[model samples]
Target: KAVALQKLTYLSSLHFAPVASHPLAFPAIELIASPQLPHRRLAYLAASLSLHPASLSLLPLATHQLHKDLSPSTSSAANHHVTALALQLLASPAAAAAPDLPVHLAHDLVPHLSRGSPRAIAAAARVIAASPSAAVPVLFKPLAACLASPDPRASAAAAAAFCELSAPPADAAPFLPLAPDLYNLLTTSRSNWALIKVLKVFARLAPLESRLAARIVDPVCQLLARSAAMSLTFECIRTVLTALPAHDAAVRLAIGKAKEFLAAEDDPNLRYLGLLALGMLGPAYASTLHECRGVIAQSLGDADSNICREALHLMMGLIDDSNVTDIAGMLVSHASKSDPEFANDILGAVLSACGRNVYELVSDFDWYVSLLTDMGRNLHCAQGDEIGRQLVDVGLRVQDARPELVHSSRTLLIDPALLGNHLLCPVLSAAAWVSGEYVNFTKDPVELVEALLQPRISLLPMSVRAVYIQAVLKVITFCCNLYVERLSDSSKEVSVALNGLSMDQTVSGGSDAPIGSSNGQITVPRMMEKDPFSLKSVVHMIN
Candidate 1:
């Protein structure tokens, strides 16, 4: 069996998930209760792998052996390894997943968290997390003392234990007393890992106790300035960004550190983390973000997508009333040159920013409308639904913007090339609807009619084609109304011209014919020729 341990280990690795009825289950159980030490260890290893935590019925079989292994060795035979393995089993998915740990085992388990072994302490914390009532009165003080232990291993393990306790924040009020201990570890412990865990706990704890924030701010700043470990530095920056925003000095220091992260071009991890940290800053520190816009812009093209995404996120934050026009332009431009996926990401971010709160950041609706149109024309543009919604929404909500909206819509609808792009179908539909609904705003209704009736529109889905046809009808109606109004005006002008002069004057002018059609208004045959919805083009397209 000793020589076969490797085979057993390999076999254990094969079944990653637990199976209650695994063939080796019963042998492993008996091996756990065996007098031989090697058998017990191997049995524990095998059981840990295949034992489902929900198998409470099997508890009777192995509980006694586990309790015996976990219990303090009475003589010189104390094997910390056996005790460690027992704690791990209990801490793992097995007892960790247990809803209510058997109360009897709490006696042996509580001592491990206090002072037994570093490995044991951390594992005990995980197991006790399932039954937290066991930790406060019995193990909390000893665990806190371990955080102050000179050995970094003990302190880190204790910090890990506290990290678990300080989660969800509401339940974390119990760990408020550990803040002074966490702060000590934060300042004195050279272990970056321990410091990170302590910072994490503080991130949750700082809000619960405001005074702890003020007290920990100085040490956190020192760590930010002094620590070369980007992970630890980023944690300190996060602590400041999330928990201590009111402390302006620390926030500035944190933001400065974040900029350094952004500037780490060689390390994409640092760049991504830097962007993440900067994104947490509020508008009050926009100037800092603005100053680092160059680095942020550079991040948008980073080889790593996480960096790109975070870069995009922070870039969107920089958009406001004053700079949105510039920012939107830059993003849309960048999107065009990018691959399709990131291109859409850029388009979406700008759309959300400019369209947020009903385009709250947009002052010049005309410019924004044109921007939407340009985006719709982008080669990789697939943000048609959003673009379409905003287009039609602008036409509906802002009467003054309709003229520009119609102009932009005309640009999109006229492109027969765009009709085949199913992604752009929504955009084209919106364009058609906008052009027709705001036909009065259109300077050239005939051109709009031509665009709406383009033959390639057959490539559009039925729903979109219906919208296109309806738009054509609206354009026709608008043109008809305009023609009638102009006709009435021309007729009135002719009447005035004839009455204003004598018959001889009319006869001398131009063979005694009325000059109404020649005056300047659109005439019938000319209108028909220019209109694509006219009889000839419509018939040709139908045929």
Candidate 2:
């Protein structure tokens, strides 16, 4: 009786007695103090643990004597007070921890929660959230009954409490048949707040619980397609993405349609959310890259920089094992022509694709080399250093490009006697770990060592000699580690060796011997067991 509580001043003012012993003292004090706010104060007091037992002893009499006399108008306020007191009581640690208390407290709990204002209803939800098991099927009944109540507040509160109680449990699957009711609320009323809250609760429930994902995906997709409540659509997108990973094939199949649907969407907000959701669905659907590629490519040219950034991020996720080469080609084409920000995005993507072993991207060697040089001069100026550094690493992994790299850096690293100097510097540091799985381009160690040892070449300035030696070591290591086949459809015995030596076991010259040269001058050198250039001769090469 909030009305009575509001009317009784003395009842509202009674604070919890400090002494635990005076159970009988509160009733006499409440009787004298009961008037309007004082009654609310007393109800607040009676709700406290120290005074709980004493107040409970008198509640039966008070409910019968005082509450019965209240008219319907007064009953509403009285019910509010009673509901508040009930919630406060349940929240007490003493009541919760009492070992002898029966688990089924919902019989008494239902009426208090089902009646009263939103505050009381929300308080009841908190108590249920605190201890859900003790208030289940019983709480559900009146909550369902109140959902149809004439009072909007009662219906709203009932919806809130029902959502909390029905939140998915690890031990119990959410009863899916009830979804229609929730969906009805979301669709029938423009109560976006209530709908959003309910949807969130549904989303929070574990994904593995039956067909919940399917149920939400269709309805949400409709909302998204119609551009109804864009934020809710975004939330639905997030919820579906999160849940679809656990869905059966039928669900994934249905979810796949969202990409096609979103591709046609004109609303930037929905399109943005769609791209994100599609990106999140990446590994499961490689075709998504191709599907979104047009949109993503278009976004790169968008007036807004954030659109470009997001498009690049999506491109990174959607690029696949099969289509990566095409993607890299696209990136490199941009870089080669000096497209401003796009060249930078492609450079970063190339490095990432290479580092992560997205082999399809590695086939565009010509473009790859050009991008490397472009990035080499400008990577430092870019926003992300790690991306810049990774670009350099990709550059170092290039076997076919070593000659180009050396040629470009000739003034700095490839001078005649400068083999031992830091020709590649930090690039070589990354090169030290790069594998030769795909390309073989390194110079023969024996040839490099011999070139360095020649008296005329060795006599150059120390700085020049040091540079040669560094080049010799880098070349030798590169040749030694060569693993990927060098020859492609373009040529035979052409070893585009990376990180290792290229022997080209099959000779391009038709035979492994000198070509028809039985002349006295031409000769084949014999293999030496101790030759550092020999495959078995190097011991951890530099190490």
The sequence of per-residue lDDT tens digits that candidate 1 reaches over residues 392-466 is 888889888888888888888777888878988888888888887887887666666767777787888999999
Which candidate ranks first by TM-score, i.e. highest? 1
Clashes of 2: 58
The alpha-carbon root-mean-square deviation between model 2 and the true structure, to one decimal in Å, is: 14.5
Model 2 global lDDT (CA atoms, 0 to 1): 0.49
Q: Backbone collision count in every prediction?
A: 0, 58
TM-score of each: 0.84, 0.48
List of clashing residue pairs for candidate 1: none
Q: Candidate 2: which stretches are off by over 4 Å?
A: 1-109, 134-172, 175-177, 183-187, 197-227, 232-271, 280-291, 300-309, 329-350, 357-361, 364-373, 380-425, 428-543
